[model samples]
Target: MAKQVAENIQTVLRRLQEGDLLPVYLLTGEENYYIDVLSDFFENKVVDEVSRSFDQTVLYGRDVNMDSVVGMAKRYPVLGPRQLVLVKEAQDIRDWEPLMSYLDKPAPTTVLVFCYRHKKMDKRTRLFQQLKKTGEVFDYQRIYESQLPQWITDYVESSGYTILPGCALLLAESLGNNLSLIANELSKIFAVLGEKGAVTASVVERVTGISKEYNVFELQTAIGRRDVVKCNRIVNYFAANPKSNPIQMVLPTLYSYLVRLMIYIQLPDKSDAATALGVNPFFIKEYANAAGNFTLGKLASCIGYLNEADLRSKGIRNAGTVTDGEILKELVFKIIH
Candidate 1:
């Protein structure tokens, strides 16, 4: 499903570039990245700059109804081969039934685009089926977190930059699977690199201010090694900059790490540990090395501590006010002790 959504981007872009356009482009999806990409093209590239002033119309869903949208889309271009009626936030337009009539016989000389972002149109509805007959419909779901690293790597290379091997994974770790946020961060990296250069951890750290020594992954490593000093150092970094490393993000990561460690310990064979853990094989050694530090019982205890810390962070049954730093410090002490 994700792959199909990705393929929709280039196909639609190619059609636009070649001046082969459909009447209605229904870009509805959970992932707004591709929707915005196509929407931007329509707004900037579809009509010539001179013609756009006369022919192109941009509408927000909140400001217009489906009748208004259909009315604009029905207009013929005054100065170009095609007119553009772009509707941003089409998801917010509740009068969808009014546009169904327009979809049956849309204006041939107008490219009507709906950026129905962050929500999908009901595929079972007649409106969706009618859209397929009248124009292109792209429903892009968000990509998985596991797929983000390769996506980042591909995006950088496509933009004429080289990204180091684990650097993509590191970026994925720090940024999660939010493509827009990742893209924004990559832009910062690109600005520093000029035309093109290799993206390394140092470069990422330098541009994004997400330290190589003080992210959630590093905190996991510190905890795995039972290095109390290193663990506290990382935690302090997170505490000082809580926005970058929120307690919500930290608790889940630690809990997942401990769960994976417990799973690694019980695996009879070590060769398939990476597959089992849903992690890259190169980092399996971290789990292997940490196996000696945590028995099954200890792993359980650490997870319990993580759960307790999570509750405390939420202010559930807590005796007094405790800072995120204090809760994390207390959790680490319990884990490594």
Candidate 2:
């Protein structure tokens, strides 16, 4: 009775953008990114701005009772063909049985939309079951970190930007789970790059302006060289920007770097290390200097530290109550010592 598939929120919104009207719409979720957008679409599309003053009514669940909502739904539009009755924060209202009775015989001429933000309707409740059966219900769930890369690619392609898989993943790693911010940033890149232009890693680093000198790249370099001081400095900067540099982004990047170090640690000493690693010649010297400083065990420990750092960022168990800056400081100390 519930729409439970966790996919792009855009799929439901696209249907609404196509302009077909549903008699009842229920949008309930903790993730408001999609809910808010879809609600606005219905409100604007169903009523004219001028006529909305008289015909379209938006009610808060806490302020008014269910009787008031039923009255609004039963009322005819003033000179308009249809009416919009929107209930925001519908999760706050109690005794929804009366509302369910009205919904059983809801007016054909009235469009009712419920914005239940940051919570779910009780599945055991009859009103919830009836609403699910009769109306279009949208559940906005957060996408997982693993799938974010491909999602970013699809999002960019839809906006007319061609991005390589690695580039897409890099942006996804840098931005984390904030789709709205990712979309906003992608729009800026599209405007600057134009069609037929591919988004590259360098371009991403440039536009994102993630501090090229002492950033993840530099941190990796420091870790590879076993320079604890340099690693600490770069990591402190990273901590300072945790909102932008979420642990979701940091863990994967650090993992990838340490894994590469593990591989390099196993290889025999070679004059042409770049050719051995299949990397650009420019990176050969960097890896060459770093190869001797790391061991397989040490690299494994670094990976463990990255995982712990990630958990700390997420506020999981064993996570010390440290600010983002403190977390970075501790990570650097662990890696360095």
The candidate maximizing TM-score is 1
Measured by TM-score, how close is model 2 to the native structure? Answer: 0.69
- Put down candidate 1 lDDT per residue, 179-239, tens digits, no spaces: 8899899999999999989998899999998787888888888889999899989888888
lDDT of 2: 0.72
lDDT scores in order:
0.84, 0.72
lDDT of 1: 0.84
Clashing residue pairs found in predicted model 2? none
Best by lDDT: 1
Model 2 residue 246 CA deviation (Å) reads 8.2
Please give the TM-score that candidate 1 achieves against the real structure.
Answer: 0.91
Q: Which ten residues in a row have the lowest lDDT in candidate 2?
A: 1-10
